[model samples]
Target: MVVSNIISGYQKTQKLSVAPFRQMQSAFDRDCLFTEKIYIIGYSFGDKHINEMIRVAITHNPNVKIIIIDPSYKDEKAKKAILEIWSDEIITPQVENMKFGEFLKQQIK
Candidate 1:
């Protein structure tokens, strides 16, 4: 059985009504608020809900650290674009310009 609450495509009117989605969102918010470090991987910052949660978390916890890992961020333009998404907040997230596999290998070493 596959249980997913993913909003596919550009359906802007779709709302997350499933219990699992709610639970997951709640957990994500809790983790964002309490966790000292957040490592983001391959997220495009397209989801408004997720972005808003992250913004709120940053605002609530100014000392929390953010680490973003994405190969595209190797380019200065791409890194700037990602940073611009959160321009409203005063943050300088540590960026890892590498693929997930490479990051995992480094972590295992």
Candidate 2:
């Protein structure tokens, strides 16, 4: 798995004096090249970055299915506009406001 490789790579190179963030980004880029799909899960501040990444990824991989697990979709118009544009491309454009337990249950099923 890409995630496993990421963690293992991090562990192996923790003391290698390289910028871990850059290395991880490179790893993700390489893995994504041949990846059929990607499931990005994030919460809180990470939620912001993940949302941004989703936009960027979707721009590149227009058909890549995305799941925005718990984004703050408080802006109704913005949410609707985004869904209109990206619904077909994403697995679920808005799972943001759902309770974590319910979201997990739905995802598993």
Candidate 3:
């Protein structure tokens, strides 16, 4: 999927004019994909990035869902708090730190 960052109210393309926001929207529209069925996975340095991704995904597809696996950062409590907030979306079916194989299996089911 395409990825981009929102900066100062404007979308800054890290690459070419092939901006991430446009690309992501195109992918979804072309495929006639459903936002609720889509998943965004991230970890570590990706913690904030993943949030940004979800923000963008939701802006484009309001019904989109997200799943994040952020191991305790700053503190365990903070991580737990973030996970709780992440649970608000109805489309989010699961959120955990399972192995890649296990995550894949669960997603497929």
Candidate 4:
């Protein structure tokens, strides 16, 4: 039920100082390890820790599928960055040039 895991930009330092924040990050890492598919929506891929977690998950489970839904992914630079992170030949993520709402509508249909 608690969706907001990381602290806001103003509280960035608190992320490292707070125990609960560390636990939340650990939980995210654990989930990545077990999840077969990951749907990343509108994430800037700015968090090195989260990016590393996903990389580790893919390394541990090569069969894991990644779906990235963000309009900016249509840009070559943005798309290239994401591909570079999950850069295994077998771990090709399904990149979509659409927003989350649009993706959901298509899925519903």
TM-score of each: 0.79, 0.45, 0.40, 0.79
Ranking by lDDT: 4, 1, 2, 3
Clashes of each: 0, 0, 0, 0
Report the lDDT tens digits of candidate 3 across residue range 1-109.
5344433234334332465656664564443334564443444423443354554555556665555443332455435435643445434434556556667787699
Model 3 CA lDDT for position 36: 66
List candidate 3 segments past 4 Å from native.
1-12, 18-34, 45-53, 59-62, 69-94, 107-109
C-alpha lDDT score of every prediction, in listed order = 0.76, 0.50, 0.47, 0.77
Worst 10 residues of 2 by lDDT: 1-10
Whole-model lDDT, model 1: 0.76
In candidate 1, what are the lDDT values of residues 2-99, reduced to their tens digit?
A: 67656567643344545666777778889999989988898777677777777788889998888889888756644653564467777877889899
- Which residue window of length 10 is worst by lDDT in model 4? 8-17
Error of 1 at 78 (Å): 5.0
Candidate 2: where is the Cα deviation over 4 Å? 1-18, 31-56, 76-96
Candidate 4 runs further than 4 Å off: 1-3, 10-14, 79-84
Give the Cα error of residue 62 in candidate 1, in Å.
0.9
Compared with the true structure, model 3 gives a TM-score of 0.40
lDDT of 2: 0.50
Cα error, residue 82 of model 1, in Å, equals 5.6
Q: Write the per-residue lDDT of candidate 2 for residues 1-109, one digit (tens) a residue.
A: 1232233323433432356655665666555544656644443322333344555566676666645554454556445536644455554444456656767787699
- Which candidate, 3 or 4, would have the higher lDDT against the true structure? 4
Poorest 10 consecutive residues by lDDT, candidate 1: 10-19
